[model samples]
Target chain A: MTMPDSSASLPAAASASAPSTKLHAVAPTALPPGVRDLRLDFFRGLALLCIFIDHIPGNRIADYTIRVVGLSDASELFIFISGYAAGLVYMSAVAREGFLFSSLRVWRRVWQLYVAHLFLFVIFTAEVAWTSMKFDNPMYVEEMNIASFLSEPHIAILEALLLKFKPVYMDILPLYIVLLVFFPFALWLIRQSRLLALGLSIALYATARIYHLNLPAYPEDAEWYFNPLAWQLLFVIGAILGASTRTFANSGMDFPVPRNRWLLGAAIAYALFGFGMQFLWEHDLISRVFPHGSEAFIFPTDKTNLSGWRLSNLLALAYITAYFLRADSPMLRWRVFHPLIMCGQHSLNIFCLGVFLSFAGLIVLVEFSDSLAYQLLVNGTGIAIMIGAAALLAWYRAKERMPRKPAEGPAGGANVKSTALGGGSAE
Target chain B: MTIFHFSRRGSLGWRTAVMTVLLMAAFSPGADAAEATPPQDLAQFCAVPETVLPNGFLKHARDAYRAGKPLRIVAFGTSSSAGTGAASRADAYPARLQADLQERFTLPAEVINKSVGGQSARQMTSRLEDDVVSLEPSLVIWQTGTVDSVGNLQLEDFGRALSQGIEMLEKEGIDVILMNMQYSRRVELLVNYSPYVDMMNAVATQSGAALFDRIEMMRHWASSGRLDFDNMPRAERASRAAKLHECIALQLADMIEKAVRR
Candidate 1:
């Protein structure tokens, strides 16, 4: 998921430091009441849960995830939402504190994600190494792509630090990090003209596909799993939609919410087509009609280049979801979805925890019998852990924001200050 | 006699003659001729002990090759088979094996890799219909058990899934080669891998599939100093791994040839 930067929460501070420019004369769009939109958080939370289950490989729980019935899966949602959220936070920042401060804020977030990616790499490598050694299975390191680190410590570590080498599931974050690093520029371009930004993004994506362009992986002569050049289109689209939210707000305009019956019907029909196509593809029925040679041209679903089919499917799904699930819907506020909401609210932390937990879950599924009951227990337990961790983080942040006790005076103020510092470090 | 006379005439000639005799002794057919022989270039890398395949192994691949049809072999498994450590995709064992088979038999060959890194046997089983059976390959080399063992998956479930996968392949008239795990120093210490290996062996025997003992072969390489896992410098590891993959390709080709010929 594209993690929203600290600017998302500290909009007041951003507005307080606003420069007196003509840009500010238009008046900044009001920030969302809370740090997150409930709809975005709920879906992102669901995406995280799906990702956890999918990563476990042969588990029965994987069958129930959206990917089974649809062309676009959690990866699409995670990335799109990330872009949307980043646009929401940063654009609001830009509208308030001007472009310079907002860009710095986004870049700082990129740095934070990069550091987190490295930290995760080290921990994941250590986990594989420790497990392999403890279990007498050095091949596990090789299996998980950690053998390069062991065999070529200096080069591999350097490449990893440079973000050129990423282990298996560690790939997506690097994609997010790169996109986020360039997001400030994209946001600015988008601010200038949405059509121009979108046109540039789509043109780059097309060029990447035509030229087979991608960032090279170090040590291995392969390309990044999620090619930034191709994937930028989706992120840019999400961002543009997000930026439009503010642009519309400031100008007293509103985004068309798919109210037209024909548009809604088209969206449903498109979604159904995607589902049917994916089902046929999964069953290998589609291959009979579209041979391997013609498949790419006819229905290009290649994930690396983010093919046109995938993009269309994502757009259709997004449109349908947006039509059905408004941000302030009572269904979203229901207590049943609180876990997902909490998980979404604390996405960056929960995503990391989800990765580690998914690995742990795989081990559990393998170590124990992979019975239906056991699989359910494992998946259920993992979801609980993710939700619990999110809740814990939320509680900690809430406590940090609690007002100081008046009777305790300076000591209470000092305590709150230390707690806030601790919370910041925790994030 | 002439060579002996030349050797007596000069020390250099004598050295050349001795080396020639040793090479002949190594390559010539003996009472143990039924044992598979690695190609001359790969002899140094042949650390594996002698292994015998059941009669008619790889018959489908052989039949396809003989008919001048494309011999399709799917390399199915986790990272090693998926080309994780290989410098390039072409350097992967399956691709190298395809090259070897084409050259050896003078026929077109397609070695499709249906491996995903970090997948266990159970996961591989779930994907069989789409990844393997749908490819319509004549032969499948399934490198599994490593992830299952590493992940500590249930032995019974792993066995059942593996058996079911092999059964499905056999029913489709595809030749099956069950490749065991690669030897790893760290893994040897941390996991009791013998049970998993034994389970694969049993499965291969019961299902009439050939078992490619990669674990023992890799261990032999490490023990015989052919592959230096302990002290090799970090920078040279990729080259070393590439060499290992090449050696594996050579060994796999040799096994297929022996089976087909038998």
Candidate 2:
């Protein structure tokens, strides 16, 4: 590629060079790289869909669909995407505006996340309280004391400052904030050299795995539902991708097909080996090393440690996705894929609104049995509502971004309706 | 090529030998006999007593073990009487009491426990006539005060409701064993409970029903450090207490068993 022009659409030397160097022009018709990555969006949308299905009261399809697709529970997917998006967006900020700007941006996002968390915490607590009062059932109330709620204000303030809190049902935001706090450091290392970033990421992974140390998800006395120590690997991987994108894209890193039959045979054998390992793991063959039902061995397990099994599986999945479902593959461009893309596009708004609506919907239908039929009815309704919500959000965002007085299109003040229709890009 | 072949052959042979050894160990002759047997089932280890009574009030039940013509007793209370917090259901006081009755007397009796976790005396009382008395038990082990005290149930209401339960059981000639509340897991919390237990004891004495003072036994265990409530895990302590409770339960069961037999 030519040297980045100072007066180009992109800002400067560092900023323009990095993201562009990584993007491969497989399809001429594809959108610009910085504006949007369809693959990431598609994956995010797929995660949301899986999560919705899984959260439904008693859907039979959820179990089978999730296990097969590796998106059974969306906790890993959500957090993984969070890291990936942070790396993409924050890394860009660091490249353009330097460390201070990126650091401030991360802090701003943390504050926003904290506010969202607080709102959720209040809503859930109020709902539980309301339900308890109405039911007058002791069983309905779980660990509720007025002291608990009163204590929260002090803890939350401390958490906002220190980026730590005691593990509660609603304390994931603090963990994310803590992760993002290190973005400047991560970006600094990446800018210094790609090798340093790679080495640091590997070192972090090794430390977490070898020491088996888990940093506090919450305060000193709380259990983290999702251990950030293990989850950090996902973010690190994303950062590595963002940092070395230039090298990876230009280096002809594509997995070439085996010309010699022996290599293909070996690949098949190696795949079988992986499958064999899984089978043996399931049957408790290697009991001494890994006891069956070992906390680490569980599927999409409680993100405690980046267990070898899960990490291996993720690697295998990534390989398969890269080889078989590469960016410009016809499989990804199917008409059926549009819904998932929409969900991914409006993810933040959709997730927030969807989760709130789901809870409300469940409460409204509380008296109904958690039978198969009821699950179908609820899930069907949920899917429809999510679609409707996405459309509404998309429309609103589109309107907000557009100027009231439309500028003349290419034809000297001729009405430029085409840009509004098909050319509507990301905000 | 020759070196590679040799190395590969050696590794493969090693792998084969290891697998063979594992298979041999797993399926060797008389291996089944050599293996340790699984623990006996709950039913075999803990025999539920069976008995029949004239008016269908099961006798000799500390909690739900009755002996008579109908041979059934109902024990309805909170988690303690239900025999939770023990290593096994067989280790629960009610089961131990049933076994003791079986050994003491020749009466056949069955003890059915309808106790649930986190139940209060008032909740138990509300369901007394239906869940307990309706079972046509020859004996009713009416344990309530601990839950009532914890719940801060009105003492006047507690006494009246308990008396009402006793009256209902007695009308059917069902011997009622009024058990005092056991000591709390946290010894300091006992103060909140013991006075309520005493009130229950007073009602039992006034009504002329058999009294099993579990609070005294548990307090003794705790003070003597025999149960080690403070040092041990709550689960372990509960199990130790269950053994002590089982001993008292045995005596109560034997007394009822003899009366039923006579």
Candidate 3:
């Protein structure tokens, strides 16, 4: 199981050690099950919400997101967690049901993601198209970023099927879909030799950056927004950590908790350096410091190919996270976090719905008043709707599960032997 | 007093004069305060600070400028370069730049505006060979990001197109100056233009193309009460647009002269 037993006093019993406890022995030799690690759910849910707020352009709340503090943003967090959760679920399946059976399970999840992506594309297109036709502003059609799509729906549909017709915020799912396709192979490779898999992942990343290996987008001479070739490294790293039993609670990265103080200090220092870099941007003194803006000091760390700067910053943040986070911190049980956990549990639905809501929110801001009040309403209502939808979905799933044979019951918290339809299924 | 009949809104002094006029115009009943305002000597309004040196050395362009050779420059961009808001094509920055550079150095310079309306970086890149590379100009000022930002194009895709385009131009031995979006407070608030603007700077730094900070310049002008995009009267719209274009041309000429002449 990804977490220890949490059945009795679900939040408090997940772990016995204090977050600050030092000089602890290596993690308990006996790894137990029957615990659903809410840490994964918590972080994923937070990332999803950040994505939602960030997607809606001009949302003031987005300034507080990870983007301002670090080079990597929600995209890294999302992909990493996707890999981590997949590992926790699928690795167990591979061990119990054998390789071929687990592969089918992997393919099934890919299919689900593919279907979900296609549906999102369709729904988003329809939303933009309807707005383009209905809006009074003639510039509305162009500003919606679907001008080319409307001109040739037939070709656009073909391009979308090829995973090439992404228009702005639609790029996330395509990357996710492609990454999932590579997951089963990565899982199998890790099973062979973890070190070799890590080596290959890094090599592939380097090769992709050097050779500019990337899938092209349609209607432009540009490449995909999130290059799967480059991004798979992050996914693989996450998956490796997820599958390992040596990993500590609340730490998604494949690193031990209660790490040595020196290593912790180094990670904190790097994180602070990254934070300090943000101040150099867009400032008048930037020219004095870098003599050509900060890119000279810190290279173009654009989110295209997962630049080394971005990756290292993310790793440092993960290291820091592993140090402080605990599986069942009392803070996790607070009422404020309940919504985020629920949203995390049903991330796919919530993420898709959030994308749809972003478009609607943008239109409202543009077509009507873009006043402070509307912004407040837009963010407030949008989050409430996501949380409400998540709560309803959770209720509906619980009702559905009530009828099924509770063969494993709550004891099988992380049991992935239940097939693709009912594996760990955090995704 | 000479009005110069040009874009004279760059200085802090002129902004104060303009703001005073604006206030009088608002207060006076049916009075034409713009006409009533006195002529003013401008400081640095849209002025690129003298200390901000061009990051990319214009070695080829410099040598050409020093040799008294005819300098052929390509003005590649979208609407602003096409003189959409400006009164006429002649008043656009490229045409004005030819005049500004010719008068300053008395060197024959041809700044051909190869800009089309409503084109983004991707569309501009597609036309690089035909409209820009074929010209074999010593330099190209690529203005972009407004259309991309307004259209909500993927920022990553925008970055890719820009770097690729700049890299291609550099390969042809042409110095590139990347011009970012022209600013309007409404559009700035309506769309998230900062990322596109930020991406432009990042690309320019990486690719070693000098960035012409048009948005910040215009934004400074607005904040100082120089040219109010939102509040400009319809009667003065054409003149203001022309002045803005002229001021931009003056700054470009100054920067180019500094970059090349050292």
Model 2, range A1-427, lDDT digits (tens) per residue? 0001111211122443333335444445543334445566677777777666654422455554433433113555555566656655565556666779767767776676666666655555444444333332221111122213334556644653454443222334555656676766776776676456656666776786677555653333323434566666666565555444323343222221212244334434545555555454333343335543342223322234545444444444443554455444556678788777778777766665555544544442332223344455556666777777777877886687566435543463223333332132111
Query: All models, DockQ values?
Result: 0.04, 0.02, 0.08
- Ranked candidates (TM-score, high to low): 3, 1, 2
What digit string (tens of lDDT, one per residue) describes model 1 on residues A74-111? Answer: 88888888887777667766777799987887878788
Residue A191 displacement (Å), model 1: 1.2
- Model 2 sits at an interface RMSD, in angstroms, of 26.3
- Estimate every model's Cα lDDT from 0 to 1: 0.68, 0.51, 0.70
Best by lDDT: 3
Reference-based lDDT, residue B88, model 2 = 56
Positional deviation of A8 in candidate 1, in angstroms?
A: 28
Shift in Å, residue B210, candidate 3: 4.8
Task: Report the lDDT of model 2 for residue A300.
Answer: 25
Q: Write the per-residue lDDT of candidate 3 for residues A345-392, one digit (tens) a residue.
A: 899999998887776666555443345566666677778889999999
Query: What's the lDDT for residue A221 in model 1?
Result: 42
TM-score of each model, in listed order: 0.58, 0.52, 0.71
Enumerate clash totals for all models, in the order shown: 15, 23, 3
